[model samples]
Target: MIEATNLAYRIEKDSMGERQIPETAYYGIQTLRATENFPISGIKPLPTYIDACVLIKKATAIANSELGCIPQEIANAIVQAADEVLAGALRDQFVVDIYQAGAGTSHHMNVNEVLANRALEIIGDSKGNYQKISPNDHVNYGQSTNDVIPTAIRIGGLLAIGKTLNPALASAIATLTTKADEFQDIIKSGRTHLQDAVPVRLGDTFGAWAQILSEHQQRIQTAATDLTKLGLGGSAAGTGMNTHPQYRQRVAEILAQLINQPLQPAPNMMAAMQSMAPFVNVSSAIRNLAQDCVKISHDLRLMDSGPKTGFKEIQLPPVQPGSSIMPGKYNPVMAEMTSMVCFQVMGYDSAIALAAQAGQLELNVMMPLIAYNLIHSIEILGNTLSALTRQCILGITANSDRCLAYAEGSLALVTALNPHIGYLNAANVAKESLATGKSLRQIVLEQQLMSEEQLAKVLDLEKMSTVNG
Candidate 1:
């Protein structure tokens, strides 16, 4: 260790070369090299991922000590250090970039080094004293990056979906459901291929949106179940070469206790190590959800298009000024934002799918990319859904008069005369209404195709909008 002017450097070496790490950093040489090498994304790994890694370390320490694989003193110190991390300490210590070494070796080593150094401090030893508690020999006693990285990603992803995304989705669903009920009686002109169609209840449209999201929420929860099957004890090549026979089971139990989720070991370690299909499944579900979000946001944008020149059938809450030059102009900022997020999530799903397919025979080298993209999708979509619910969906106001006017004036209203007059006659009425710029009811009444009482019954907008048994 060398003390320079205002900056202290600790010398650390690996097979590649020697590097000086900051004396205050819990991370060591491997993490230093990773930061130097991968500056691609300019974003660090998420703190939730770090938390999952630390929890794995703590569980590993407890499991190893219980199995007599490490001394009690060392295990106790490591657990204490990892506990500090779990409590949100030393967050900046995990400094590796989101884009880093294959299989996330740099990330695994970064956590190991941090835990090792903190354990040293707990044992009254200075930092960088690998002799007292080596990152590999003690902190990573029975694990390999191949197993740890994927397991950590799964753990982190599941927690995020459960704690954040699921609730956000539920809130969105609730808001849409409420809107559906509120708009149940508001009949509007429905469009197909951007052309006027028969009338539909605005509530039915909102209910359909809610149903789509509810299905997505269920799919996400189901896919997350597969994440709980972990590949923890499969060392470098999924052979469990160095770990004890009971290490995997013991670690799963400890992890279940720690996270309050019942994690279990994979039935076949080799299959688990070589395949990332579970993650791909979850990503596919997220992609489906993103697709739905894009549709809903686009629909909202179209419905709220203009106060003067566009549909203007519904009004979104004005959250911000949409333009710099236009006065009193409020855009559908939340809907646009949600659409952009959904597009990004779709891109991430593609990346995740490609990464999942690139796995080789023994181990997948694209775990780091998978972890980064999966967690990012979950976090951003969660936040976006929450914002869409509160800032946009919940505050939407229907232009009932506009909706009624559109419904009353639409040529499609001629369809109601089909049962009474006939399809050909109704078609003529629609064509004549369009040609003369007269309403369908006006054309029918002027032509005397039906009596006034019969026309009123045939043109009952509310009954036309209602679903027939």
Candidate 2:
């Protein structure tokens, strides 16, 4: 390490040449160039992504050491450095922009340099002293950005799903299921094509939403299984050149223990490294979930539309004043926020799809974009859903009276008379009830379409709304 005369900066050299780096920065030359190169987005690398990279370094260090590829002392230092990072130290050192170089070379090197410097410090050496611990030759031995980045993305996604998204989804599903049971007795008008169609149990609506989320969870989990297959040993290309013969298996076993996931090497390392399909698959699953969430949010807003002029069949907990000036206004802000987040997730999914297909011969240069969007989508969605469940779903209360009134008033109630009075007669009763502003019972009774005894059995709202009734 060559410190500047002022002691504030140090000189670090790469293949292109040397530059003055801040003395305190753990990152070295290539990372410094990336920071200077890409300022498109002010966003830095996400912490989960950082954790993924660090875990990879730790696993690789152990594997390389065990294989006698790197000195045991050096590998021990590297492992200690990675452990410090994993424990949340030196986080701000990972400074590469999310929109940096193709195939994430810049950000990969950022991780490498930070670990190398930290390992140097562990060995009581000065930072930027690559001779003792080179980022490429020691810290990132037998690894390449092409393989490492994709593996990092996979691990990052699994971590996010296990730690964040899955739990949120499970919570939301549980809340919906409980609400379904709680609201089962409340009957409300069901709408199709924005027109009153029939009566349904409000509980069933929540139950249906729960089922939708459950299915989405299964799809996401299935997609996540693909993430367990890693291409870490593939190195620069699928060839696995320079890697120890046992490096791939040992690293997979090591990483599995670290992540607590059933990780394995891909049967086709080339395909794993080259294809962004796993990321895309997970992204598409998230997109599917987002679409339904948007619909569910819209349903919430619709059900809670107004106290006077709209449905108002359900009341969402008023979190804050919905309007700037309206004294009692309480918009469906939670639901609205959910829709917005889901929309963003959908957009990220689209970007991931395009990027998944944009790869060339042996690797996808678009991995960085996919990495950011996929992991970010999972995390933000997890966060949003958790908030939605806590702030909205759990606090919701059914407007039982309003729901009953809507169910009784809906002209679709005449449909029960169809089997007894025939379709044409039921249609006539519905039309007359609408024109006269009278209840379907009154119109049917006035027309004597059925006896009072028959109407009593046919028009029971509970039985009509009940499944299989």
Candidate 3:
């Protein structure tokens, strides 16, 4: 066995070999080796994920204790240690990278070892004294990496979406709806294929955006319900081999109570254990939401394109300087940021989709990457929605004069006189206006196709913009 003295090391052995572990570390040799092996991403699993694992340990400890599977004292110690972890203690002990082993065995062992050592310390025993409390036999009593890791992923994903993303999206929809109401009186020319087609209220554009986000929120919530069905007691490959039959139901009930969400055991444990479809569904919903955000951000950028030569229909709140050399330039920074975040989330969706389909026979060995990407997507989207809502959507100011001018000048406005002067005359009016560099209104009045009062009634901006007017 390897040994050290100046830093106070402990000898920990595995089937592969023995190694020196730091005496002060709650994590043992497995975690230390994982840290060395998977030095890929500096990012660790999200804190919500760590908390979910700790909750699983606590629930298992209580369930095992109730079934007399372990000594009451050991179970009590495990529970206390898990509680400490939930309270955010010893977070540094979980040092494995998010890109580690596909089955998440490294992360599973990290949780087991940290809780085992901490329980030993709580019971007045030294760390690594597994004879008193073993990581496998005690802390991870009836669970397998297969069941625990997937269960923890669902738990963490649900929690992040519920507590972070859903609220942020709701706030964004509300902000958009508010802006929609504020801009109802502002008339503008609407474009189809980027060509002027008809008159539309600027408010209608914001209303459409709000409706899109509302639909996405509903889709995400519906998909999240699928996550409530868990595979926790399907030890190993869904055989439920080492677990009591009642263990699954008890654990589900306990977790539901603890998390305040109605969680239930999967109807088919084998299917649940073998499939990653639930994760795929959630990822698809997130991707759909991201796509909507991209469309919205691009529209905002176009609307706020320029103050001198572009559409300039609206002005975005200036968060920072847009250029180093351009003196008085401010960009739509928030919208641009939202677009980048959506693109990243879309990339995550592709990764999750591929990982979900990569499963073979009885288990998917890609849980670690799936979990990492799902959590990251949720967090980034939530932050993006919040930033877009507060910094851009809420602070936007409509350029009413510019909007009215564009509406009045658009050649497509000739369509409003189709019934009064007939389509042939209306087409000629539009063509002459474009060719002569004159406004549609000016051309119609100069041609005396209709009296000024009749033309005014036909080309009423507010009436043309209203639905079914």
Give the winner by lDDT: 2
Steric collisions counted per model: 0, 0, 0
TM-score of each: 0.96, 0.98, 0.96
In model 1, the worst 10-residue window by lDDT is 1-10
Model 3 C-alpha lDDT per residue in residues 104-145, reported as the tens digit of each score: 999999999999999999999999998899999999988999
Off by over 4 Å in 1: 1-6
- Each prediction's RMSD over C-alphas, in Å, is 2.0, 2.1, 2.2
Of candidates 2 and 1, the better by TM-score: 2
Better of 1 and 2 by lDDT: 2
Query: lDDT by residue for model 1 over 1-469, one digit each (tens)?
Result: 1222438778887789888777888889988778878877678889889988999999999999999999999999999999898888999788787778888998899999999999999999988888889899999998999999989988999878977899999999999999999999999999989998889999999999999999999999899898999999998888898999999999999998988887999998888888999999999999899999999999999999988998999999999998999999999999999999999999999999999989888988999999989988998999999999999999999999999888887788888899999999999998887888887778888988999899999899999999776
Better of 1 and 3 by TM-score: 1
C-alpha lDDT of residue 423 in model 3: 96
Off by over 4 Å in 3: 1-6, 445-451
| Minimal lDDT window, size 10, model 2 | 1-10
Task: Kindly provide the TM-score of model 1 when superposed on the true structure, using C-alpha atoms.
Answer: 0.96
Error of 3 at 50 (Å): 1.2
